[model samples]
Target: MALKEVISEFRLYVCNEWISKIPSHRFRNFYYRKVMGFNIGKDCSIHMHCSFDCAKNLIIGTNSVINSRCRLDNRGTISIGENVSVSQEVIILTADHDVDAADFAGRSIGVRIDDYVWIGTRATILAGVTVGKGALIAAGAMVTKDVIPYTIVAGVPAKVIKMRREDLTYDTKYRRLFQ
Candidate 1:
C-alpha cells in the first residue's frame, strides 16, 4: 500500500477502535466532524459502539438519531436525510463482491435513505439501495432493492408490506446521558 493509504488505514482503525466507542455525544460528534470528515448535521446523535468505515463518505442530515451498535460501511457513499431514525444494530453496507464475476471482484455503490425514514432494529440495507422518503424498514429485514416512498418493508430480502402515512411529521432528536 502507498504510504498515505497506510496512514489513513491506521487512523481509521484507531478511530473505530477507540474514538468511535466513546460515549460522550459531544466528543464523538466533534471527532466525527473535525477528525473523520463526516458531514453530520445539527442535533444529530450517534450512540456508542457504532462502527463506520471510510467516514468521509458518510453524510447525515439534521435531527437524525442513529442508535447504538450500528455498523455503517461507507466504502462508497451513504447519504441519510433529515429526521431519520436508525434503530440499534442496523447495518448499512455500500460495498460487496460480485458473485457473477470471474475474479470475484469488489463492487460498490451508494446507499441513500431519504427524509423521515425509520429503520428498525438489526435491519441490513445493502448496496445501491435508495430507501425513499418516509419509508419504514422492519426489524431483521434484509433490503436488497430500493424501497418506495411511504411504504413498510419486512422479512428477508425485504418485501413491501404496506404503505405508511405521507403526513409524517416527526423529528428524531434524541439525546442520551451516555450516547
Candidate 2:
C-alpha cells in the first residue's frame, strides 16, 4: 500500500480503537480537533463508542450532542450545524457504491444536518442528503433525500409524516459523566 493510505489506516485505527474508548470528553475532543483535523465547535459533546471513516471531513457545530455508538462515515464531508441532537446508533453515511455502474464504482456525497435538527436513535442517513433546519427524524428511520425545514419524517425511505412546530427554542446541551 501507499504511504498516504497507510497513514490514513493508522489514523482510523487509532480513532476507532483508542480514542472512542476514552471517557474524558476533553481528551477525545482535543484529539479530534488537533490530531484528526475535525472542526468541532464549542460546548459540543460526542459520547463514547463513536467511530469515523475518515478524520478530516467531519465538521460539528456548537452546543450539539452526539450520543454513543454512532457511526459517522465522513469519506465525503459531513457538516452538522449548531444545537443538533444525534441520538445513539445513528449512522450518517457520505459514501456509497453506484449499483448501476459497470465497474461498480464508489461515489462520495456530503451529508448536511442543519441547525436544531434532531436525529432520532438508530436512524440511517444515506449519502447526498441535506436535513433542513429544525427537522425531526423519527427513530429507526431511513432518510434517503433532503428533508424540509421544521418537518417530522418517519419510516423507510423517510417520507414526511407531519409538519413540526416552527417555534423550536430548545438547546441540546447534554454533558453526562463517563458516557
Candidate 3:
C-alpha cells in the first residue's frame, strides 16, 4: 500500500476503534470534526462505539442523534439529513462486492438518508439504498432497496408495512453529557 493509504488506515483504526469508544461527547466530537474531517452539522451526536470507515465521505445534518455501536461504512459516501435518529447497532453500508463477478471485484455506491428518518436498533442498510424522508426502518430489518418517503418498513428484507404522516414534526437533538 502507498504511504498515504497506510496512514489513512492507521488513522481510521485509532479514531474508530479506540477514540470512538471514549464516553466523552465533547472530546469525540472534536476529534471527529477536527481530525477526521467529517462534515457534521450543528447539535449532532455520535455516541460511543460507533465505527465509521472513511470519515471524510460521511456527512451528517443538524439535530441528528446516532446511538452507540452504529457502524457506518462510508467507503463511497453517506449523507444523513436533519433530525434523523439512528438507533444502537445500526449498520449503514456503502460498499459491497458483487458476488456474480469472478474476480470478486468490489463496488461502492452512495447511501442517502433524507430528513426525519428513523433507523431502529440493529438494522442493516445495504449499499446503494436511498432511504427517503420521514421513513422508519424497524429494528433488525435488513434494508436492500430504496425506501419510499414517509413509509414504515420491517422484516428481514424490509418490506413496507405502513406510511408515516408527512405533517410530523419532531426534534431529535438529544445527547448525553458524558456518555
What lDDT does the true structure give each of the candidates?
0.94, 0.95, 0.93
lDDT of 3 by residue, 8-65 (tens): 8999999988899898988998999998898999999999999988858889999999
Angstrom error at residue 100, model 3: 2.3
- Which number leads on TM-score? 2
Q: Give the runs in model 3 whose Cα sits over 4 Å from its true position.
A: none
**In terms of lDDT, which candidate is stronger, 1 or 3?**
1
Residue 153, candidate 1: alpha-carbon lDDT: 100
Among all windows of 10 consecutive residues in model 3, the one with the lowest summed lDDT is: 170-179
Per-candidate Cα RMSD to the true structure, in Å, reads 0.9, 0.8, 1.0
lDDT of 3: 0.93
Q: What is the lDDT of residue 165 in candidate 3?
A: 94
What is the TM-score (0 to 1) of candidate 3? 0.96
Best-fitting candidate, measured by lDDT? 2
lDDT of 2 at 101: 98
**What is the alpha-carbon lDDT of model 2 when measured against the actual structure?**
0.95
- Candidate 2's displacement at residue 53, Å, is 0.2
